[model samples]
Target: MGPPALYALLMLAVPLATIFAYTFWTQDGLTIDRTLTFSNYREAFNDPLYRQLMLRSVWIAGAVTLATVMTAFPIAYFVSFHVPQRRKALWIFLITIPFWTSYLIRVFLWKVILGYNGVLNTTLLGLGIIDEPLSFILYNANAVVITLAHAFAPFAILPIFVALEKIDRSLLEASRDLGETHLTTFLRVTLPLAMPGIVAAALIVFIPTIGDYVTPRLVGGPDGLMIANMIQTQYLRLNDAPMGATLAVLAMAIVAVISALVFLASRLTARIWA
Candidate 1:
């Protein structure tokens, strides 16, 4: 415990403390003033652009979490219940194949797929689906959602699969013997049991997605940018480290509150179902 705790404090705590400390200071040109002040936080809360970016980040992250979890649940159920025991490992291996490739490459491939003259549009045009390629799919919030949902699908699936596997098949058999329909059994038994994994998967997707700068940079154009993009701008482009730190702290606080609410809500729901 001593070594691990010391390591955690050094790696995680020190960096976080430094960021938080930076938020209280001021930066002018090349000089970072050590005088403690709340000006950065004041500006962050009062600025309209910051407000917009924060809301947008939360909305996009929530959307991605919903889409990923909803899609992953069915696949996890299939793999856990329908697949043979011996082939379960194979199915999981296949599901993780996406992780084998570079994340940047995957983002680029999505660009090619969603671009006006890219593969999707080319195929649609050849099929005469429409006269022109659609412009709404690329470089927008829609593209961000689609790309992220695909990228984080495996993260959502594996946890839910693990949860589902832990469920007792005998309980399901008993439910069926009591004359409940499959849907009812699933709703009353399977779903509640799987809620833990669903919550975990949602958190895993939501937290990182909110902080992701790369996907938005590539696929998310002007309208699709998130708070992370703004943070990057403040830190690197404008050389405003204090403001960047302030934004980072605010984002973390927001995530913490939202995650707590989500976890509590899930627990309540699970208890009711139980």
Candidate 2:
């Protein structure tokens, strides 16, 4: 095979081999063995807590994806269609500038902003909006969704903007010339053309958000714990390497299946437009 193909296979092999090895391997308390067994996978699927955690992880990630896309579409449209070409690159850069900072720092910044003595609560209390600090603001599902949305917003914006920029101006002109209203033109012409970018942004945000441990751990309380949190518990807290590997593999499979479904849906939508 070619060099690229060989590199790809090697990369794929490392993770697949590791997971396969771990799934069949066994452990006695702290000691792990190479003996083959299905108990790890069985436990992961059969345990009620694991199942709930996985479902919640998927749901939170989906919410983040939807929120990012909804917020990004307008900013992307403004940059691609309304901004002067010379300034568009600068504007896009500004959108992504937050990433230069440590991601952990950013999440902690939100904690400072939302905590009891944080800016938000202080300002609200000063204004007499509420008598006390809201406990739910700092460590919950809402915090996870908000912080992830802020972190991943630029990822959603740039792709959709690039896709919108690539759309042929002549096609849009033709629609207008044929007496189509601006809204109609956008619905029929602009939106369909931008679907690819929307799909790309969703995959970019959704996949990573599902496995994100840091945001949930830092900001998410007990209720916001995800599959990644469990994997971390298995590996670090419990010292169960086999179970940790099993959870990692399960999370990977869930991400892959969701990505495949999004890609397939995008293809179907493209076909219908065609």
Candidate 3:
């Protein structure tokens, strides 16, 4: 506890405290003024652009979380329940093959696949599926969601797989023996147990996706830009350290609130299942 606590204090708490302190100060020319002020927060809340970006970030992150979890669950279920025990590790290894490449490279590949004259449109054109290439898939919120969902799929799958693996086969068998259908057994005996993993996967995908500037910057175009993009602009381009810190703090607070809500919901669901 001593070493770990010290490590956290230095690595996590120190940086966060510094950022929090920065939010109260102002930047003038090249100098960071130590004068305490709440003007940064005021501007963050009052500005319509910042509000829109914040809302958009949350919406995109939520969509990415939902898509990733919904798709990953079935894959995880197949691997955990259907794959031969001896091959489970191999399947998991295959699932992580995407991580073997750099994340930036993966995002770039998705850009190519979804681009106007890219692989998907080319294939569609070759098959005579459409007269022209579709423009909606690559440079908008749809592209952001698609890219993030693919990128985070493995994170969602592994947790749900762990939860599914921990399910007692006897309980499922007993439920079946008592005349329950497979669907009923799954609903009553399996899903509640898997909720923890689902929650974990959701948080893992949502938190960072909200903060991701790269994917949005690369493929999100103008419409797909998020709060992180704004933060980067304020901090780097505008050289407004206080405003950037304020945005970062606000985003962190929003994520914290949402995470707490998810945890509470999990507890409530567990109690209901009990």
Candidate 4:
């Protein structure tokens, strides 16, 4: 391999190796020793709290992925097939403009909008829509899902749009010539061609959402907490490095397995289409 590629691999290898070693190693309250053990993993599995956190994380991430993809597909479709080529790039850029700012700021903006006395509540109260501010809108699992979905929407849109743009216009016309309805053409041609982009978008959103700590920590209540939040607590507040490392490793494993399943499913779908 080239020197830059070798150096990049070496850099990644060092930290990953350290994390793996740390997860297996034993630790006291403050210090970790290099003694290998499975006790940390056992603790993670045995703890009902961690299990719930992990399940919630996966659920939230899945929800975000589904929501973003469902919402993005239509916008991407319009941009790719209906909009003029000259305006397509501008439309896509406008869609992604929110991401130019920090992710934390964007999520926090949602918090402000959803807060009990925030914009929505103020407008509603001023217009006499409700007597009291809505507390359930923020600081919940739903809020986390919504906020993360908004944050990841652009990531989902750009890839799907690119995939749609890459498809040959002739193929779509040919499908129509064969007496296929628009819906049938979409199902048989457009969707299959867009699979790679859909997979890419899913990975971009789901993987990071699974490990996201910011949105959950800022807006999520106790029940909305994810595995990443717990992992952070273990490392910083609890000062249990081994347990924290264990949670990190578990999160990585979960992401890896889910990603692999997505890849396999996509391949299977492609094979069936072929």
Say which candidate scores most in lDDT.
1
Shift of residue 68 alpha carbon in model 3, Å: 0.1
Number of the top-ranking candidate, with TM-score as the measure: 1
Q: How close is candidate 1 to the true structure, as a TM-score?
A: 0.99
Which TM-score value belongs to model 3?
Answer: 0.98
Model 3: ten consecutive residues of lowest lDDT: 184-193
Model 1 lDDT per residue over 124-177, tens place: 999999799999999999999999999999999999999999999999999999
**How do these models rank on lDDT, best leading?**
1, 3, 2, 4
Which regions of candidate 4 fall more than 4 Å away from where they truly are?
A: 124-132
| Per-residue lDDT of model 3, residues 1-274, tens digit only | 9999999999999999999999999999999999999988899999999999999999999999999999999999999999999999999999999999999999999999999999999999999999999999988999999999999999999999999999999999999999999999889999998999999999999999999999999999999999999999998899998899999999999999999998998999899988
Q: Please, what is the TM-score per model? A: 0.99, 0.94, 0.98, 0.95
lDDT of the candidates, in the order given:
0.97, 0.93, 0.96, 0.91
- Which residue pairs in candidate 3 have backbone atoms (N, alpha carbon, C) closer than 3 angstroms, thus clashing? none
* Candidate 2 local lDDT, 1-274, one digit each (tens): 6998889878998778887688788778768788888999999999999999999999999999999999999999999999999999899889989989999999999999988789999999999999998888878898999999999999999999999999999999999999999999998999999999999999999999999999999999998889999989988888888988888898989999999999999999888987
Model 4 lowest lDDT segment of ten: 27-36
Model 1 misplaced stretches (Cα beyond 4 Å): none
**All candidates in order of TM-score, best leading:** 1, 3, 4, 2
Q: On a 0 to 100 scale, what is the lDDT of residue 172 in model 1?
A: 98
Per-model RMSD to reference: 0.8, 1.7, 0.9, 1.6
* Superposed model 2: Cα runs more than 4 Å off: 1-12
